[model samples]
Every structure is written in C-alpha cells, then in structure tokens.
Target: MLLGAERGAGCYAARVLAKRIIPCLDVHNGRTTRGQQFGRAEHGELRDVGDPVALALRYDEGGADELVFYDITATAEGRGAMLDIITQVAERCFMPLTVGGGVRTLADFRALFLAGADKVSINSGAVANPEVVRAAAEHYGSQAVVFSIDAKKRPDASGWEVYVAGGRKATGLDLLEWAVRGQELGAGEIVLNSIDADGMKTGYDLEATRAVARAVDIPVIASGGAGNALHMRDVLLYGEADAALAAGIFHSGQTTVGEVKRLLAAAGVHVRLVQHATLGW
Candidate 1:
C-alpha cells in the first residue's frame, strides 16, 4: 500500500504542473497568417502562411498542450467563414481547442462550444456586456468561459488599457480593474494579449501579465511577444502566468514545444512532456 500511496502522490504532482505551452493560430479570411501585429488602425500586411487546419494538425502532432484559433477579421463576411473553419479544425483535432473573435453574447459562446470548441474566448463582446461572462459560466460552467483582454500601455497611466476589434479600438479601461471584474463575473481563465509587444519578439510584457495573474484566481495565459524558449520561461516564471501562448516563434519553425519544455524544466518550471500521435502514420 506504500507503493500505491507513492503513485497517488505522483498523480497529484502531475495535476499541479506549472507553465503550459500553448500554440496560437491567427486566422484571417479563412487562411492562416504569421507575424501579424495585433493592433492596426487600418489594414496591415497579413501574409498567408498556410491553411489553418494544416497548421493546427502540425502543432497537434508536435505535442502542443493546447491550441488557440483567433479570427482577425471584422465583418459579417468574415464571421461566416470563420465558423466553418472552426468546425473543420474541430473535426480533425483531438486536443482541446479554444476559439475567439467576434464572440459577443451567450448565444455566440453557445454556438462556438456547440461547434466543438472546448472553451470560448470573449474579448470585445465581454467588455461590451460584462454580464455575458457570468451568463456563460452559469450555463456552460466556468471552465468553458475565457476572457481575452488585449491591452496596450497608456501614456498617461502606469497600467495598460484594454483594446478591442483586433486592437484597433481602445476602451480606456484600467487593465487591473477589468481583470478583477472579469474574475467576479465568473471567467474561468484570462488570456492577456499584449498589443505593445505583439509581433515585436522582445519577450512578453511581464509587468502586464503578472498584474493580471496576481489580480485574479483563474489561470492567465500570456499571449504575444514570445521570441524563443527563454521568453516562454521568463513569462511562466517571472510573469506568474499559468501558460504562455506564442504564434510566430512556433509557426515559423523557430522553436518547438519540446525545446521549450526542456528549457523550462531546467528553470525549475513543472511541465508535462506530451506525446504526439498522428493518424495513419
């Protein structure tokens, strides 16, 4: 029975693992893109890298712990196709998927979850209707709700301000206050996407990430500005985030999930070594 007790301890240790590595896929007009900045006042150069499904499959096969798909368009035309893409990716992927972009109401959250998304991430919509998060959590459980907050540092304030519509519009809300409010509204997790550091590869905005993580009890996923394994480790360790989400670095073949995990292990961050499985190998 002592051996059984030891095994149980190991299982508990695994459940408490720190620093998850999540790969992000930015989809624009039904195709995958890379190196695209989050905040653009007008149309920006969005270079199509490949198909979303193809890229997601590669990340899944490369042992990504989770996958996030963000649609970067702002029109009815873009919305219809984005759902179709989500459906296609969901049908093929075996891992948990989180989808965001243009999700405005509890109905939107329900539709996305019904389309096979494990979680629905709300950004602009949640800001518009703060009650939507609570409504979603009430109906779909807290685990199914995620608040994606895109923030840019305001010159007048010491903290960041929330931005929406692909970071094209600034809401002037205090980042810390909004994070606290999101937690109160029953958001399961928070995805703090940094507009200032996005596509810059300078490393994550640790100050912003840590502030939100410290303000809320839910898991915070740091998005944007991951250039390498060290960047991931810095965010997970110093930023106090539960997970680090990257796009360009991973999509461009600059870093692999295994390499990041090994580096984190060396830094005393607990991470699970996931095995990738491919169908019909």
Candidate 2:
C-alpha cells in the first residue's frame, strides 16, 4: 500500500496537465499488429501492419504526444522485449517513448532506459513481485515507472479483477484496490486497459476508468475500446483519464492521432497541437 505522503500527490500535480494523444504499437515477433480483442493476427495476416520503425516515423510526423510499444507476447513467452526496436524508435522519435511487456526486474528497467526508452511499463511483473515497483522507482525516479493494469469486470457484477500475462490469468485483485496499491508502491502513472472493451470499438469502459482514476493520485491513461475520436473525448473528459491510448483505430487507418487531438481540442480539451513549422507562429 502507498504511504500517506505519496497518496494523491501525483494526481494533484498532474490535474492541470494537457491531455495526451498516444499511439500504441502492439508488436508481435517484430511486426506491429492489430486485432479485435487481444487476439493476434497470424504472421501472414494483413493485420500485421508493418515495421514498427516506419509506423513510429509516421506518428512522429503526425504530432503524437507520445509513443507506446508493447511486445504483446513477451511475458507469456518469458523473454524481454526486442531492444533493437526501442533503439531504432528512440533515434527517430523526438517525443517520449514507453516500452512494456516482459519487464520483470530492475535490470529490465535498466536495459530499457539504456536502450533509449524514456519510461518502462510493468504489468505482470509488478503484480507478481510488487517490490520491483519500489526498486525501479528507487533506482530511477518514480516518474520513469509506468504500471499497466489489464482489468476485466467481475462475473458477479461487483468490480474489476486484475489480469496478467497478456490478459491470460486473473489475479483475483480488485481493480480499484490494485491501482491504489500501485500508487502507494511508487508508480508514477497507470495505464488502465479494459479487457471488456478490448477491440470492442464501443468506446472505453468509463465505469472502470473513473473508478480507478478516483482511487489513485497518479495519471491514469485509458486504453482499449476506442473506435473513434468521440471515444477519446469521452475518456479524457467524463472518464477523467489523463491520456487516451488507441491501437486498432490508428493502426487500421480508421483514425489518426492528429484527428483525435483536433476533435478533443474542439470539444474543449487541452492537448498539444503542433502548429505548422512551415509557417511562422
């Protein structure tokens, strides 16, 4: 559990921050992928978008607030994320880069940072060994640690449960409780991925997002179920998420990061819009 000194401090400090538009690259075996839920499109499938380096370059030109790369199968396969991709992306992207999947120790965080990752995200590792969260924060600052949580609604309609190992196992932990504990444990931010909303295109599970956001003091990034820009607006405003992460909508060419940011701006949300470097401001 987080101490009283840590509780809600991060959240309060971030209350006035601009809402971020993040593009997520779900990589499998070195290729970017998109699927309806957590399912990965097979190697030859058209859903295997292309090289992550190319996609990162595109998003960088499009004015994305940040880039997130998740090695979708790393934890399940018991290996680390490909460092070559992170190195390539860091060299090309000017914005912050967050890498996740298969992060299990301080060494993992060290390797990711040394390889050009601005931040490291840990899900299963944090759940399995909560001490790693503290260790990472101690080694690096808490600001460099992002704790990702995969959550699903309970069968009894009670609350959400934490899922780990690429959403394959349940931890029987309450979503709200885990988020609070994560903040207490020194995580700088939280990425709340909704299993129920994964690939649904029905918009985010605002109920789950709001519940977790209210429970913690850190920034909460809403992930999954984003079919369009309206969904991103809803999550940032009503759901109270500090950032919105989308994979399918952007990967499938259904939407662009600029489109999402523009829509949110029109809807009265504060976001970083890149004015034309072509024209003097």
How would you encode candidate 2's per-residue C-alpha lDDT over 1-281 as one tens digit per residue?
A: 33211332353345339999899999988999876657743434326788999999888888887889999889999889889999898777776788999999988988888787877899999998999999988867788889999999999999999999888899998999999999999998999999889888999999999989899988999999998999999999999999999988887788888878888889999988886563232
Best model number under TM-score? 2
Q: How do the residues 1-281 of candidate 1 rate in per-residue lDDT, one tens digit apiece?
A: 12111222333234435668999888876777765456332456676778889998888777677789888764222363266777787778766788888888777876777676777788888888899889988877777778999899989758899987787788879899999999899987899999889988999999999989899988899998998999999999999999999988887888888788878888889887775454221
Give the 10-residue window scoring lowest on summed lDDT in candidate 2. 3-12
Candidate 1 lDDT at 251 equals 79
Q: Relative to the unseen true structure, what is the C-alpha lDDT of residue 12 in candidate 2, on a scale of 0 to 100?
A: 30
| Pairs with backbone N, CA or C atoms under 3 Å apart (clashes), candidate 1 | none
TM per prediction: 0.89, 0.91
lDDT for position 65 in model 1: 74
Report the number of clashing residue pairs per model.
0, 2
Report how far off residue 156 is in candidate 1 (Å): 3.3
